[model samples]
Target: MRRLPLAILAIALLVAGCDDAGASPAAQGSTAPAASAGGACQLLDFGMVNAKLGLDLSVAAGASLDNTFTCVLQAKGVSYPDLVLAVSSTTIDADVFGDMIQPKNATAVQGLGVAGYQMPTPAAGKAGPGVEVGWLAGNKRIIELSLRFAPGTPDQRAADAVPKVVELAKLIDLSSL
Candidate 1:
């Protein structure tokens, strides 16, 4: 439970420390702590996300570090409605996907990757209501997308984010990362 969030924070910090010079928002850079970091941002562009999530947004930043790639997308010139993506190395087995990878409240999802889960993110502090979709990709990799709405967004719209997040998750190609 607590392990997942800590792992994500560590990955994010590692990504932030890497250099992304000359890398366009779409490229996600080739620099990494180890190995050639592939084009992770290409997995889902703004158009793909906007079409599925019904929001106009742009890539704020993207970079890859170690075995993880991180991308952040958001509405132009605003911080609200931030969508963060992470594709990273994984060790979890599919057999324990539910019991180990996801919390008790998470819903099991299929077809997105080797195994998948979706869960609602409750608002806390400066963060707003959101939805998270996570899936296991090939080569022991996992992808997690967290989409957080504006704090004042209506309850229905926040609830609606669940399906949208799942749809956005499907756009990611498991073989690419």
Candidate 2:
């Protein structure tokens, strides 16, 4: 009879312990990363810099201007137009913004400096069919960094381009900019 009582007590303790184990950190009211105030931008860490950008997304109603930096390249007699790094209140869409540009198969990478921040190689690729787009995000923002290579360019050149984008992403200041 004593052994039966001890066994019952042990089972009770085990059940109590299981209840504690099932409680998640969130359920315990743990703190989460701080979200942006306007819910427009997110912060990102790309190994070298820290920054935030707009996501070009509108959550509720109003349309806002995209906050982005851009540069153009004219190499090897080709006009690579429409290179833009713009941030919106809701989305960060970086792309080669012009229509006359084409993806060049040549693997040429360049960097730009904006107000002391190095803009990452804007996500490079074609838009559709021959277009490519890349995106990265933080808890508070969505970053869509893209590029359009001059036609006849292979994707391999574009593969090496993402790190530059990561580098540039580090410069965004989501809290204020």
- Per-residue CA lDDT of candidate 1, range 52-166, in tens? 8887665356666666777666554466687777877768877666567766778888777878889888886666788888877765777888887877766577688898888
lDDT of 2 by residue, 1-177 (tens): 111232223323322232212211111111232122111213322112112211111111111233322211111222231222323222222232111121233222233211111122333343211222222223223233333455555555545544544444444433334
Which candidate tops lDDT? Answer: 1
TM-score of 1: 0.77
- lDDT scores of the candidates, listed in order: 0.66, 0.27
Could you tell me the lDDT of residue 63 within candidate 2? 13
TM-score of each: 0.77, 0.30
